[model samples]
Target chain A: MNPVKVILTLIPFIWTIGMIPFVNRVKPIVFGLPFLAFWLIAGIFVAFICIKCLYHIDSKNNQDS
Target chain B: MSSESMALAIIFVFVIGITIVGMVPGMNKKMSLEEWAVGGRNFGRWLNWFILAGEIYTAFAFLGASGWAYARGGPTFYILGYGALAYLVGYYVLPAFAPLGRKYGLMTQPDLVEHIYKSRTLGILTAVIGVAFLLPYLQLQLTGLGLIIETCSYGQISRVQAMLMAFSMVAVFVYTSGLKGVATTAVIKDVVMIVAVVFFGLYLPIHYFGSVGGMFEAVEAAKPGFLALPGGTKALDVGWVMSTLVLTSLGFYMWPHFAANSFSAKSADVLRHNAVYLPLYQICLVFPMLIGFTALLVLVPALKTPDMAFMAIVQQTFPGWALGLVGGAGALACMIPAADLLLSTSMLFSRNVYGKTIGKNTSSESMGKIARVMVLVLTTIALLLAIYLPNMLVNLLLTGYSGVTQFFPMLVLGVFWKKATKLGAFCGVLIGEILVFGLILGKMDPVPFLGQHLNAGFVALVINMVVFVAISAMTYKPESNKG
Candidate 1:
């Protein structure tokens, strides 16, 4: 129900939709890595960020409660 | 043993070792019934993350997804899309249930339903529906394990023999560790599955078709539908795709094992944090589709069973060592989830149904004993069903999904809407489930009424919603109870 939380959650869903049409569009390089490998690694990094954000929010809420 | 058999033996031994560790008594040394069923409601964030990931991505996701892709072309991508969609939906619904689970120390979907409805008849009906649907779903995992063993052994071990071996291994761990066994095995399964999927997803396409572009080119040439959005005669048609996605997304959290795991978490924060990271677990699925796409290129038309597609590709294409590893990972994927399903359902049968109704004062030790015994009985029944059943793996899973989703109206409505009366909830579930089962068995076409391709689940959900809203509208509201 939190607007910020909802927006953050939508990030991955939107990212996934973008990747769909172009997933097969292979690139020679992304930061000196194959496109597929690079994309997956980047996604993992983003996931970590999201996890950290969520953890912070949850901890703050817990403190308040 | 042959070289392949020896490799499998080592993997099996490792799996058994983990299972034994899980079964050790002190791992879950709590006296309360809630502690026994839901891991004392004290799993940490890391454990919760791993457990939730493991439960969601079963051998079905690994083997079944690729198999679907190979057999059905682009339509199978819906599996990946649907899974992600389901997780997103769970993120929203899980928070509502976590507090309730903590307050009531609930263990199963029926426990929550019965609490809200306060009806013994509804409780029993929910349990029966859950167990019935779970039977085929569990059997599908067993069957997946059997195929993995049979394929890796190269016919030295028959499917039935492999199934028996895998089933016994699961039963032992589940009997010993209960949910603890499932949790430990899940960590191992997730590691193996993620590594295998990522490796294959990247390696196989390039290995077989030279590149992703080449893979698509081949697919377009052979089966144009593979490039189509919905894929294959619109097998992923707009309506079907949306319905399947929404149904499964809403239905995923309703599974009894998930509820049990949610309750097991140390705090509600653990649940929230775990849900945020859960999508990462599904990253493995992207590769299974690649494997499926690769299989279509390399495999001949004669080799086209939905279950065999992934296995056939590995056996025919990969080297002996790689094939062995894939097989081991596949078996672990199936075995971990099967153990969890078995243990969770046993806990449900013992604590929720038996303990609540038959013996109110059953001790934790007695309940644990009953749980182990039920594990044996349920696994035996599921084993028989797996061996004797004639349906394809994917179809069998859909049947279970549809049947289990009947509980959706009860759980989702019960928590969010205070106006939802106990009578309305019970009547809604009953009418919905009966109609759904009747349609499935009778193959009644609801297209006449809705003009859309409707399955048992969609039909049941419609009737359930109607009854719930109408009855709730008419009936008097109970005093504002927090639960």
Candidate 2:
């Protein structure tokens, strides 16, 4: 496994759940959502993009997928 | 003539229509045990996507989500994290499972455990736990269906009658169409469910509260911190959120049905490819929470059953036809997955229990037949529970969820760690499950030392990992029995 691919995969774990303790707030609402709600929703897209990039690379590096 | 009749009529149409949709494939061809239990292992993109979604989303998505958001506040966001994280984990893990499965014809989770440990007893133990987890889930579906129909039909049909009629049809379709039927109905269920869920999820906030932001702003103003974690209950804070997220994400794919789905993939590539897009579904979850938050201010006197928040608001506000659509979608959400769970759980009995014990020499055909019979027997039990004890599933759900997480160490370590042994795996499971159950049953969850910061199950998982690693090291001998 590429070290970068491994990091990219783990990013969501930190970004999604890791960021939770710090982002547990009601203010600084982004685009009408509470900051906490906004961050979690954004986390979903972050996960999708991260996985998409991983899939692109893995497909090229290994045919075994 | 009446609103109740219009809604009820539309729901009945959907129930029959989905059954027919599911039944057509199995009408002429006799679906093999292999086809229904493990799938044909040749699912395309749509079917793969449908299979995961079918297994994942259910009435819990609608009622339970919205209710918690409506009643509790911030902790509901935890729901969004677990699925995305589960997929993230699946991206790497499932591809591993695919090839291992094909080589061994691993049709069930117990089969995997059996293969990994070279122990039929551990396999039987897994089958027992797998069924234990599934029964609560199946009960949740039946009760969720009953609630949706009873509320949407304006109480014209009692919850008991709705569950009886609707779930019997679900069982019939499962009996006839098997896995292909579940897949076919899943495609349709998702389409209707998406449209209805999105519409209400968006419409409720916009129509009542002016905009989504306005809804949150109003809710936060009325109840400060309600927009953040621990907003609903004191027991749930950031630590609880963090710990629960750990427990659930690690444990999510450990469900036996997920194992079945992973094993049946045509290629490791298929499994990896699907993982990429599945996270997108997590975005839809935000809608239900939005509806629940919107209901918090709008509903006077609040709701008696927090789960009724989604349906109650829709029933009060929408037209009959719209309510019918949501009800129909909700029923499908419940039924399709419930059908899959029922079939899979029984096969656990027929394959793992019966195959290993009573009739070790039985043919695959006869095993499949026994599994089919098991579906009806299990459904009858679930239906009886749904009618007599609606709240039991909710109570068991807490322990049941944590109980499944204990399997994580066994599955992940067994796959990656060559040194892992059968004795280690078995002992770890036995001890972990006992400790987890003891803590939960003793009401020491959120665990005393950890306080309310960590989830009780995560504590168990940590211990499980320790024992698994420690025992495996002691038991390790140079390239002994691979099983």
Worst 10 residues of 2 chain B by lDDT: B445-454
lDDT of 2 at B415: 86
When summed lDDT is taken over every stretch of 10 residues in candidate 1 chain B, the lowest stretch is: B445-454
| Model 2 Cα shift for residue B420 (angstroms) | 0.7
lDDT of 1: 0.70
Total clashes in model 2, counting residue pairs 3 or more apart in sequence or in different chains: 2
lDDT of 2 by residue, B42-80 (tens): 777778889887766688887888999988889998998
Per-residue C-alpha lDDT of model 1 across residues B386-444, encoded as one tens digit per residue? 78863744444555776677678788887788788877877887887777767766656
Instruction: List the pairs of residues colliding in candidate 2.
Output: A65-B269, B72-B232
Candidate 1 residue pairs in clash (backbone atoms < 3 Å)? B23-B177, B86-B249
Cα deviation in Å at residue B6, candidate 1?
A: 4.9
TM-score (0 to 1) for chain B of model 1: 0.91
True contacts kept of each: 0.07, 0.83
Best by lDDT: 2
Cand. 1 TM to true fold: 0.86
lDDT of 2 by residue, A1-65 (tens): 68989888889889888999799999998998889888888888888989999999988877665
